[model samples]
Target chain A: MTGPGQMLRRPLNPYLAALVSAVVLIGTLALAIEQRAAILRDGREILLKTEPVDPRDLMRGDYVRLGYTDLSSIDETLVTGPWPDRDTTIPVWLTLAPGEDGAFVARSASFSRPETVAAEEVVLKSLPVRVTVAQPSGGLNAIGRLEFGIERYYVPEGEGLEIEKAQNQGRTTVAVRISPDGAPQIARLMIDGETLYEEPLY
Target chain B: MLRRYLSRELDQWTRSGLLAPGQAQVLLADHDRRYTGFSLSAVLAVLAAVLFGAAVIALIAANWEVIPRATRVIALLILLMAGLAAAAVAVRRGAPWVAEAALVFTLLCYGAGIALVAQMYHLSGDETGFMLTWAVGALVVSFAFASAMAAAGAGLLGFGYLLAVQDLFSGSGTNPQDLSSYATVLALAFAVGVAAWRSRSAIAGHLSALLLISWVMWVIFETTELEPGYVLAALGAVAFGAGSFTPSPLTGTISRHGAVSAYGAVMLLSGLGLIQVSLVDPGLGVEMALAAFILVVSVAVLAVAGGENRLVRRFAYFAFACETLYVVGETLGSLLGSFGFLFLGGVALAVMAFAVTKIEKRFKKGEARP
Candidate 1:
């Protein structure tokens, strides 16, 4: 045992161990909470129409699985900039604008963040999606899938099916707040233009 | 088990006049004192903590609506703090086992708290991220308290993170383009190695070694079109060389557990077995050559470290027997049909049994001398 590990064999003072553990654990939790809270408080808000499915998570209870309209699968022609060389997941910048139903829809996308967009359009960052198929005509024809990290709306046990039903009927929409970095956080859940649950900044 | 065996052996030795009656009691007492850290009470305490932690996690998963989300968060935080406080108190009272159990409880609470918050805020993160965060928390605890249990926990969680990222279990090889994922796992494994060393946990040390081996295998499979069996064999040869030939001081810590030699033997045998299976229609020449190579390697391993290392010796004997049977089946079975194959197999095994008896005697003699 005579090695670097040997050098570290002396246990920390019990009180010191306790203090350090508290600070690290508490700080991590607080940071996670604050990051989401900041986005909820100060980021741009937009409502997007969604289709929901239901699934139960072992650790996180029942939840509605959401698929945003026109966001999960974007037209390849809308992609601007050079595509990745290999089939791998890469973040794409999506520019969103209000559609006829007042829910935001993706207008265009790019491999890199757009330098500018129309005054009414807001740019949102997409979770990394695998580029599955590329067209010879300088556009991505198909991607594995896109995610915004707002796909799942955790709900009380056994209640996810109701929201899933509403969403499948084209009646459910999600209000999401996009931080400056293009990360989107769920701000509220809505059904038929009425807020069902509003998130509180903790 | 060790204590029981030692107790029985001590009594037998005393009765046989190998030790005086009172000397046996002194020896038993010394053994008990030295191994108190790993007593049954400690194991039971840790098990109880694990059960309690699981209950807390289940409560969070139930998403109990009676308590508001914010209140639930506060309660979890309080629980985590209280667990840490208890660990400190246990340490102060000189109850190391209780302190370790408390630390394990707190780490579990931290993970459950993460799950609870993720659920409450509707955060859509993958399992890899969740496991990585939990592992990092466990690492912090390990370092803070110098707790071996916490280090082992971190190692397990790190393994979970690796599993979540790669479909390794599905037998679909890793995505070659995702080198970053493997690198991250390697880094985490290295961190676990350091933590294991710091905490002096043999279990964690073994885990870290296995993790590194797994990463190498993943990379080899991903990056190369060549036979993974051959690659693994070469790697194992190198490891075996290092483990057996590396001079003391350099190999002191690693060889203390004889892990390197054992893992090397495992890889070597597994690689050879893979080659044997992969050769679906190999000509007689190739099959015989592979069998000879396998037999040679097994013997070499046995001759090198088998005298001292029981694990390596067992693996060597297993590999030798399997390769012998395989060669017999492949060559003689094809020529003579089932009846002759059975006769030849029995004769070969009987001969092998005689040789193994001799080898075992030699090994015992070597042990006795040392």
Candidate 2:
């Protein structure tokens, strides 16, 4: 019981209270930021020559699901090997060698050696690099509220919902990086090969 | 004394017209006058038997569709009738033993009905409808019979319903098990409290507070690798913090449990988040900043606001120390690691051991003195 004597004995520290609340707010924000950076820095990957499909969600808004090319034959543990630079299936940059058909294909990954015995056909397996993206413009053209950790990007729900409407009538194809999570929760959203919606879970 | 308290609370019902003033007067007089030859403990035992019997049997009945539906329905109705008769006898007599037995039997009837419904609807996984159904019946019985046990059963049923909704319906994004679940459960608990408070039953108030605290601790201390239950953790922290200041034993117990839980959960979550952040994306300066802020503020508030309350102060102190250690460890990972993580772990174990010993000694000495 807080007796009258005890209640009147002390005053609380305002600076401490403010500091704690500030810390909670800042911590929440920073955790958010670090998560974004992880999505940007490590959680994303490039899938060359892929397709996009619009998916509808009854819960948690709406978005698109991206289907990327399959990666078979991975070392499972990429800590050391020819792809020594590879870490978790997180994203990095990769340059695609294009063909006349506009379908860019590659013989090997950026991390593969050029100094090996002889040059042979290398069908682009796994690229140990991040893919550079084209940024879009205008509120009319932007994807909004994109989430879900699909490799390259998760379709933003706002724009994703809108696109889901359009794509229900049609389908679009775009290159995407698929996370090892069976599906990337949401790395970023893409539109017409442009990086639009993006985020990373730390 | 109990009669007077009950009359005061019962007055509200009379005013609200749920009971006639005459009926209220009669009930109050009867409660004061009757001697059921049954002790309160015996009544409580009967009530427990009824609730447990009903819940268990209902769960059994849930799978009893192989029997004819008509037969099942008939059996359920029979159970309900028996329960109602038992309740009538208990109410008319005003004996705690009979009241408890009646309440338990009624609960059994409720449970049987729940089973039949589950069987009928083939309700798999989601237990909300069952709990909701039971809660409504229990509520009616509690008010009609003025049974605290009935109120408690209803509260538990309602709490279960909340848990089911969150567990069965949470989405893929924005963790369902986070602060939202705790919020929902707490709201339900508060409603139960109000119901109990209106009854002016100490038993009701005590039970409500006890359950509320447990839920608070559960919310605050959940630290699975699942990552995001922390939102609940924050809400729980606030809830428990508020709870600690209340002048109720039920609330006090919850506060102590919740404070310790929140402290432990934050420790685990922070460390896990850090390791994950580093492994996935190293050098996360902002993550550190955010974690630090949450730690410093929560500890400070508990400490400064809590003042001389030994339990609250002790919990706050622990949180402060733990978070400080986190910062220190993160800042001096190399130094700690050079001595080895195992070595640090050993030191932690030793410190804990010493603290435990000192606490026991103090407790023993205090007891001896008294």
Query: lDDT: which candidate is best?
Result: 1
Per model, state how many residue pairs clash. Answer: 0, 35
Q: List ranges where model 2 is wrong by over 4 Å.
A: A1-202, B1-71, B84-98, B117-127, B167-169, B172-190, B198-295, B305-311, B317-370
Candidate 1 lDDT, tens digit per residue, A1-202? Answer: 5576455787788899999999999899988888888899999999988864333322224777888888988888888877665455567899999999789998888888998888888999876566654546665456656887777887878887778778878898899998878889898998988999888887
How would you class the docking of model 1?
medium
In model 1, state the lDDT of residue B29.
91
- Candidate 1, residue B298: lDDT: 96
Question: What DockQ does model 2 achieve?
Answer: 0.01
Model 1 error, position B198 (Å): 2.0
- The lowest-lDDT stretch of 10 consecutive residues in candidate 1 chain B is B168-177
The alpha-carbon lDDT assigned to residue B28 of candidate 1 equals 86
- lDDT tens digits by residue: candidate 2, A1-202: 4586344223223233223322332343334334434434543354333333324332233224443332222222222223322121212112234445444443233333333322212222232222222234422211112112232222223555544443344333343333222122233343454665333232
Q: How close to the true structure is residue B319 of candidate 1, measured as C-alpha lDDT?
A: 90
